[model samples]
Target: MKLKRYLWIAVCLIALAVSMLPAYSEDFFQHHREFRRFLQHHTGFQVSTLGALNVGVYEAAATLAELKSHGDFGLGTFEGLDGEMVVLDGKFYQIKSDGVAYPVKDNSKTPFSAVTFFRQERSLRLTGRMNYQELRSQIDEQLPTSNLPYAIRLKGTFPSLKVRSVPKQTPPYSPLGEVISQQQVVFELQNVQGTLVGFRLPQYLKDVNAAGYHFHFITSDRHKGGHLLDGAFLNPVVDIETLRDWQIMLPSNTAFEEASLE
Candidate 1:
C-alpha cells in the first residue's frame, strides 16, 4: 500500500513538472501575446490607401481581392474615376455615371479607397428634419471625441438626396478637382429609401484623408448611388463604429512615386 501511494505521488509530481515546463510556458505566452497584438491592432480593420488628393497620381492601385481582405464596409472610387465604389456587407458595388449600381468584379481595381471591418458600437435614431450639415452637427455631439476616425451608416428614407459620380478619365489625367468640375454627373432623387456609407476623419488627417464627412449613398433597391453632395433625412436610423486602428497600403508604381504630392 505504501509503495503504491508513493508511485501515485510520483506520477502527480511528474505531471505537474511537465505542465510547468519552459516549452509549455513559452507556447502559452506566445499564443496570448499574439492574441493581445491582434486585439490591439485589430488586423484587417480599417484600411485606407492613397490620399484623396492622389487621385491624379494613379487611380487603380490595389485589386478588389486585396481590398476585401482588409475590410467589408467602406467607400471609394474605381480606376480612372470609372464610378463610385461602395462596399457593403462584403460585396463591392460600382455606381457609374449612368446612375446605376453594378457589382464590381473581383479583379477590379481602385485608386483611392477606405474600408473597415464594420462592427457597430453605437446607434441612434434621428427624427424630425435635418439637412446634411445639421445631421453632421448632431452626430458630432454624440461622438466620444473628434480626435478619432468614425464609420457612419444612415439607413431609412431621405426626402431629398443629391449626389454625383465622375466619369472615367484617360491617361494624362487632370487633377481630381478639375475632373469633377468638368465631368461629374449629378442626380437628384425624392422620397428614396437607402443607406449612406461614410467616414468622419479627424482634422489631423486632412492631407491623408478627407478631413470631414465623406459620404456615398446607395438606394434601398441597390440600383442607384453616388458620392453624396447634399441630403435631408426625414427619419433615419444611424449606426456608428469607432475605428481604433488604421492601416494604409501605398502604391509602389512609378506614377505614384513621381507624382508631385505637394
Candidate 2:
C-alpha cells in the first residue's frame, strides 16, 4: 500500500508540472510579442517622402525633427535643392556646393528624404581593394533577395573618394538632371575616414525611388561630404539591414500635387 501511495504522489507531481507548462509557455510568448512590437515601433524599417522623380518639388514637406522621430540614419536633400543630406547617428548634416558639411537645424526642411532607425542585422568585413562597381556586385551577392529595400552603411578609410553636391534652386526649379548638370559641385578627397549612408531599392521601385544604390558621404570630422559618384574602399566594415516595411509620406503642398510625376 505504501509503495502504491508513493507511486500515486509521483504521478500527481508529474501531472502538476505538465499542467504548469501551458501557463509558462503562454507567458513566454506574450513577452516575445511585446518585444517584437517594441522593435517594430522604435526601429521602423524606412520612411521616405515624395518620389525620386518628382525633382521639381523643391519645398520642405518634413522637418528634421519630424524625420528624427521616424529614423536616425538616412540621406536626402534640403529644401530648395540646398545640398545633399547625410544623416548619421541621429544628426542631420548638409553638404553644400563648397564641398563642406554643416549641421542642419531641427527646423530645417527636406524636399525629398529617406531615413531609417538603423539596426544592423548582418555585417561583413570587406578587405582588399575594390572599386564601386565591384563592391556593389559583392554586396548584391549577399542580399537575401532583390525584391526588398536595404540600408547599407560602410565605415572605413578611403584612399580615393569622389562626391558631388548641388546648389540651392530658385522658383521654377529645374528637374534634378538639369540641376545636377549645371550646378553640381564635385569634391575629391584622398586618404580620409568617413561613413557612407545609403539605400538599395529594388528595380520595381525605380519610378518611386532611386532603383539601385544611392549613397551620400560624410567625413568623420563632419566637415566634408556629398553625393557619392565614385569611390574605392580600402578595408571597410559593411553593415546592412534588410528593411521589410516601407512608408512614403506624400507632400500636401500644391506643387507636389501639380507636378508631373511621369
Candidate 3:
C-alpha cells in the first residue's frame, strides 16, 4: 500500500513538471534568439570622412590598432594620403606608390578608412567574364534593397586587374583629386589570384562617404595590389556582409576642426 502511494505521488510530480515545461521552453528559445542576434550584429565603422579627404585633411584620425578594434576588413589610406590601405581577415596591408603591399604596423595611423566585421549574409556564384562595371551591375541586381550599407568580399583569380596607389603627402596637402592625378602609380596585373575588399554605401552618405562601390585589391600572396581601378572576375564567388549600421570616428585633431567640410 505504501509503495503504491509513493508511485502515485511520483507520477503526479512528473505530470506537474511536464505541464510547466511549455512556458519554460518558450522563454529558453526567446533568450537563445536574443543571444544569436547579439552575435550577428555586424557594423561598418570608419575613421574620418571623404569630405575631410576632399578638403586635404590628411591627418591621422585614428591609429591602425584602434581601427582594427572595430572590425577585421576594410580599406583606407595612411597618414598624409600615403599609399592605399587594405585591411583583410584582420591583417592590414599598405600598398605604396611603388605597388608593393607591405604589412602595416599597429602604431601606424590612417587618414581615411572604413571597416566591418564581415559575416556573409548573401553570396553569389558568378560565371563567365565579368568586368568591374558588369560585376557591379550583377551585384546590384542581387541586392534586396539599396537603402542600407554592405561590405563585400571576393577571393579568386582575376583575369585582369588595374590598380593605383598614391605617394605620401607633406603639410599643405593638395586636394585628393589633384594628388591622385599627379602622383598616383598605376599597376596592371594579369591572371592574378587575390582578394578584394570594399563597401557599397547609400546615396544618403554622400558627404560622409562615397555613394557607390569603392574597392581595394591585394594579391593572394598578399604582396601586391592597390586601389582597384578595374578588374575582370571570372567564375568568382562574391560574398556580401550586411551591416546593421555604420559609424564614423572623427578626428580629435585640429585639421578636422579647421577644415571646411561640405
For all predicted structures, in order, the TM-scores are 0.85, 0.84, 0.86
Which residue segments of model 2 deviate by more than 4 Å? Answer: 1-55
In angstroms, how far off is 203's CA in candidate 2?
A: 0.7
What C-alpha lDDT, on a 0 to 100 scale, does residue 134 get in candidate 2? 80
Give the lowest summed-lDDT range of ten residues in model 2.
Answer: 41-50
**Runs with alpha carbons beyond 4 Å of true place in candidate 3:** 1-41
Top candidate by lDDT: 3
Q: lDDT by residue for model 1 over 1-262, one digit each (tens)?
A: 9999999999999999987898888999999999865543332233334454445864567899988878788898888778898998888999999989999889998878888877777897777899999989888887889989888888887899999998888998888888888899999989998889989988988877788899998998899999999988876778988777766777667777777776
How many clashes (backbone atoms < 3 Å, residues ≥3 apart in a chain or on different chains) does model 2 have?
A: 0
In Å, residue 113's CA in model 3 sits off its true spot by: 0.6
Clashing pairs in 2: none
lDDT of each: 0.82, 0.85, 0.91
Task: Output the better candidate (2/3) by TM-score.
Answer: 3
